[model samples]
Target: MIVLGVESSCDETGLALYDTQHGLLSHALYSQVAMHEEYGGVVPELASRDHIRRAIPLLQQALADAKLAPQDIDAIAYTQGPGLAGALLVGSSVACSLGLALDKPVLGIHHLEGHLLSPLLAKEPPEFPFIALLVSGGHTQLMRVDGVGQYTLLGETLDDAAGEAFDKSAKLLGLGYPGGPAISRLAEFGDPLAYKLPRPMLHSKDFNFSFSGLKTAVLTVVKNHEEKVIANICEQDKANIARGFVDAIVDVLTAKCVNALKHTGLKRLVIAGGVGANSQLRASLNEAAAKKRFKVYYPELEFCTDNGAMIAFAGAMRLQINPDAAQRDYSFNVRPRWPLDEIKVV
Candidate 1:
């Protein structure tokens, strides 16, 4: 089956074509990061408008790259929600319209489910009944994934997610927007012992996570630095603080993941979402996996963020498992706040 996926959940617009027999054919993504950088965060109105401008052209490019026409697409899949309503609408409307035009089946996929299943796109995919750590900008969660749509929520953040903590702490250190990468990069120059930060909920006897306190700790540190004339803060200071923040987060995340694995007795661990791309986190997890004699899996870097390829791949998986999951009806609605546990096998 040939499935075309559209992803406009937030600041990025993505389009891709996936062939069940051939894997991902072609994919294109246009990030609104540069545009949103000026505002220090995403402005939903601007994001929605950019998606409108980029979606069609990206779709065209993806099709051209795949050497196929629009009619060749047998099905259309779009992220139906758990994102900006406007952004979700852009992808949903476009996908349903395409399905209607081609008289093909259309499926509405949960955004988080797309991320959760993305690791299957990797060269060495994890088998069923694995643990998934989904750490994204808007969400941080651990799930016991038995198979497609068979996700049992292990735990999630009570407040700010790990990615949000990274971004918020980066901003406190005078870093620009999309702070996860910036903070991670700056931490490379930091002395691990230069500062110490709190690791919230690290020992909480549960799979749940909490980063809000960690972010607040960063704020307190930044305020102390500002008290001594912000200009007096040196580059090394920023790096040190970044390192402290990163270490704290990594520790909490790693501990929780290990705890979850032990609790579930699952050896295969899959990390998905943008924060899963963090080098520090990966290193920590890899070392732990080796020491624990378990395996770790990750999506290709390209699939780490919000992208159409994951959406298409997820949709294809759903269709493969239950062909009736796809509907001929073009009407659709998006869920900007859908929960992953709510997803069920068709």
Candidate 2:
């Protein structure tokens, strides 16, 4: 089956064609990161508008790249919720309309599910019954995946998500927007032991996490340094702070992951979402998993962020598992918030 997927959850416009027999036939994406860079955060209104402008062109490009006509598309899939409503609408509207025009089946996919299923796109995908660590800008969660739609929420953030913490911490340190990557890069030069930071709730028997305290600790350090020194700290200080901050987060994440695996007795781990792009987090998880002899899987770096291929792949997988689940109706709705476990395959 050839499934065309569209993603417009936030600042990205992505379109792709996924063939069950041939794998990812074509994928295209346009990012508004540069436009939102000046504001140091995503502007919802601007992000929605850009999605409207970019979705169609990207869809056309995806079709062209796949060398397929509209008739060749067997189904249409789009991110339906848990994202900016307006941005979600752009993709949902276009996809539903196209499906209606072609009289093809349409499926509304959860944005997080796209991230959860992304690892399946790899050359050697992890099988079912794996633990999923979903760390993104809007969400931080750990889930147990038993099947296509079988997900049990193990734990989640009590306050800010991991990616949000990364960005906010970066901003505190005068790093640019999307601070995760920036701080991660600077962390390489800093000493992880230079400034110790709190690892909030890392020892909690429950899989739940807390990062708000860590952010406050960073603020306290910055305020104290500014008050005593009377001027901004040197680059080395910034790097050290960055390193310490990253280390605290990584430690918490790794500990929780290890705990989750121990509790559930699951040996396979799948890392998902934008924060999965973090070099430190990936390296830490990989090294720890290797030591424990647990298999770990992650989507390719380019697929680390939100994109269409994952959505298409997820939708296709769902359809393959249960064809009756495909929606043929043109009516579309955008979900600003939806629970992952509430998702039913058919």
- lDDT values for all models: 0.93, 0.92
Error (Å) of candidate 2 at residue 290 is: 2.1
Q: What TM-score quantifies how close candidate 1 is to the native fold?
A: 0.98
Score residue 334 of candidate 2 by CA lDDT.
88
Q: How would you encode candidate 1's per-residue C-alpha lDDT over 1-346 as one tens digit per residue?
A: 9999999999999999999999999999999999999999999999999999999999999999999998899888999989999999999999999888889999999989999999999998999999999998899999999889999998999999999899998888889899999999999999999889998988888888888999999888877875565456799998999999999999988998899999988899999999999999999999999999889999999999999999999999999989889899998888999999998875
Kindly report which residue pairs in candidate 1 clash with one another: 82-335, 82-336
lDDT of 1 at 171: 86
TM-score of each: 0.98, 0.97
Q: Write the per-residue lDDT of candidate 2 for residues 1-346, one digit (tens) a residue.
A: 9999999999999999999999999999999989999999999999999998898899889999999999999999899988998889888999999998999999999999999999999999999999999997889999999988889999999999999899999998888897999999999999978999999998888999899889888888998895444146788999999999999999999999998998999999999999998999999999999899899899998898999999999899999989876778889888999988788844
RMSD of each: 0.9, 1.3
Global lDDT of model 2: 0.92
